[model samples]
Target chain A: MKQEEKVDFRLNREYCKACGICTALCPKKAISADDEGKPSMINEEACIMCRLCELRCPDFAIRIGRMQ
Target chain B: MEQHVFDRLMRDDKLPHMWCRGCGNGIVLQSIIRAIDRTGIDQDKAVIVSGVGCSSRANNYTDFCGLHTTHGRPIAFATGVKMANPELQVIVVTGDGDSTSIGGNHFIQAARRNIDLTVVVFNNSNYGMTGGQYSPTTPVGAFTRTSVYGNIEPAFDVCRLAEGSGATYVARSTTYHVQSLIKYIASGITHKGFSVIDAMCDCPTLFGRINGLGDGAKMIAAWPEKTVSIEKAGTLSADELEEKVIIGEFVNSSRRSEYTEKYARIIEEAQRERADLK
Candidate 1:
């Protein structure tokens, strides 16, 4: 549990169905919505990289990441 | 169809595979790639292990490390690969006959031991690659080349089998539900223990001709409209279900320690016992 630990999320947009499951499950509240109600990252700095968002997203849309 | 991810996931260079047109294996392959790309697992670090069957040929199309092993033995090979290098992300792709019929014993052991490997079974019910043999998952009374008069045996419910055998992560998805397949595949990859995705794909060459599905499209369309959530699915009667083929994750729990964790604990205890002797 180092402060500098990094996690990676590789989002494949083609697979994403725009389900908000990830947005609702993100522990850090890092996921936000766009004009079309699609989930987007509003605050990457606050992310703890727990991956709950990635795991919960029914579409496999969002990938949580600490490193690009 | 000609201008989608399917094209990219497929080996157009190797087009005209033995499989008939509209075979669900193609879509399942695409979903597998999407999940791999989505996880960002280094392709070099990823290994695709497969057995002898139509679906097993998938290892050839993927650019990552691949293993085409003996019949019904992909799990054995996959287990070795994962244990040898726990860092390597290992995946096993097998057909219904290769996985459930012949490799049934290994399947149960892997689930009970909870090896850290992802197992994707191409459950088309009939063994297309091997002349339409009825497999372990073929519905009872389903006709096949061998079973001209419907099979007398009941098919195994793969998700339920895994759940019963102690798999840490178990799910069932079909080619018709592309998004759900990808989602389940991704979750299976991230899960720390043995994960099985029983992918129900179309096999027009065999299952179609025998079941009178006519072709692959109608066969794939035969998949249920809505897959029940694992929690709610248990309550409904199998006959009452629409889209008779259900698709969803049945289990995802990290409570039971994976093989690696258990081995580590054993080693630690051994070291403590040795030290006490000193």
Candidate 2:
């Protein structure tokens, strides 16, 4: 099996307001909405590390990181 | 040539600064240098004035005539530099507290006068240095060291403030978006009148720790997306607002001539009148 790249996503559920700002700004659509309209990761491979999703979140709940 | 400029401007011994890993201030600093390079502005003719803060350390790194002035007083110093030597292109590099808090009055007054200087406010939304205290740009209900639970005060809209203050050119960008930030800084450098460039930086030490974001990279990623320019802000509806924060050129106009130009013209006219009288 090929080694999967580690996706650096720092999600603070308590701070997350489920506003979807991250999902909207994400160019790759790597983020999707969960049943409760809260953002979730349905796909991680498409994340381009643009930091747009991270920078725009008002709540400061979602954080994207680099591989170690 | 680019490599030589970079080598001259940077101190290799300062290889590692105190800013957290992936901090945006460094990125903004690089962009500022690139803008300075693009303009081919004479290094000797360029002066960088910075206020005391984490971001202000940029003064030490750049090769230009740099001054790390008192806290929140970079604009005042820059103003003096320009007034004394109108030929030099003065740039003010300041932080949230340095630009919008203690130095806010100077900021407005400078713009009102249409001074020939570029003001780059590193808006990390907190006082990263001397502990993470609540700053003027900290969003309402956001966490801060002072606001243990959440920040209650509203944040300052920098672009709007600059535009309202009669700044000739106003722009906003985040460190995560490097390309946009470079363009904005470059444009501000070229602008004759007061130009304000708000570079949203990451305060991982104070802001990130309190807000639950790990460090610089995570905090930077938390930046909200930009939807539209400030010029088109009124035309957009609530539904069209994609990003929580709006970034880009907010205003660009040549309504009033710069302070230097007006002063020179006035002096010249007065001299001609005196000669005619004689």
Candidate 3:
């Protein structure tokens, strides 16, 4: 059986402005961005669940929730 | 942005606000929503007013009772709203150009009266909406469309102006300090008298492009190096503090009665004195 993830990092693409702040500020570099600046999950294994991306994102498009 | 918060505070139809890419308006709006939510003020009782500017358009995004007034008149309109219905929480969202240029008198007068209004000034230094014209808060030697050879005029500090104009609560925070910005705005909302929160933000497409400051993320990254807290600011020499933006609350006091409350008292006394005539 596959292991469950400890946390969830969600991005609402419809609301994202492609500012790339989350990708730039992510401590673990787990998030990457496309050419136009839209962010995407790159390596989920290295996640620290710090949620700085959610806190600092200008557009409020990112959300990280800790799982029980 | 929690799902619940987004659903509760924002206008879903307006998803992905029209602000420029990497603009600081979105961050400021988010901070405001969180702050208002923290204060637990009823959305109906709270009113948001704004003037003409990129920042002033913040009214269209919120789920609060709002008034998008004409250029440089949101504060005046808010004053009237507060006077007519003292029960409402009046919040004025203004830009540096709107508040310090044509509306300068209204901004200072509102503070002088100690009115119950929470004014959040988005000081991006340049007029972003109007082709990056240098505004009253544009730092000296900064490049703008109008300042082709760099600005020669000194910048006006909004926080200092608010403090000197008798504002009961005054705070200075950058969009970079999202957590502290939310706290200061929340404190301002709960405070009884005039509150002025200067939210210094980046104007990437305009201010940044004109000054060669790179994009939005780079400007936000520079916030830490450019800003100093009040405690640290006191220790720094004038020369050292020249370019450093000071963050933190500068004033918090309730020494004087709120303008609306004072007006209500006068109305009561007037009614008593004219009882026989009625």
DockQ for all candidate structures vs. native: 0.03, 0.04, 0.71
Question: Candidate 3 lDDT, tens digit per residue, B181-230?
Answer: 99999999999999999999999999998889989888988899999999
| DockQ top scorer | 3
Kindly report the docking quality category of candidate 1.
incorrect
Q: Which stretches of candidate 3 lie over 4 Å from their true place?
A: A1-5, A43-48, B1-3
Stretches of candidate 2 exceeding 4 Å from the true structure: A1-68, B1-5, B224-243, B270-278
Q: What is the CAPRI rating of model 3's predicted complex?
A: medium
| Model 1 C-alpha lDDT per residue in residues B1-278, reported as the tens digit of each score | 13333344434455434445557675677679889878878868989999999999887776678999999999998988887788899999999899887899999999999989999998888888878988888888889988889999888888888889989999888776667888899899989999999998877778888888766545655565535655666888877664465667779999998997788788899999999999
Name model 1 segments beyond 4 Å from true: A1-68, B1-16, B225-235, B238-243, B268-278
**Lowest summed-lDDT stretch of 10 residues in model 2 chain B?**
B1-10
Report the Cα lDDT for residue B195, model 2.
99
Model 1 residue-pair collision total: 2
Please report the candidate that would top TM-score against the real structure.
Answer: 3
Reference-based lDDT, each prediction: 0.77, 0.79, 0.90
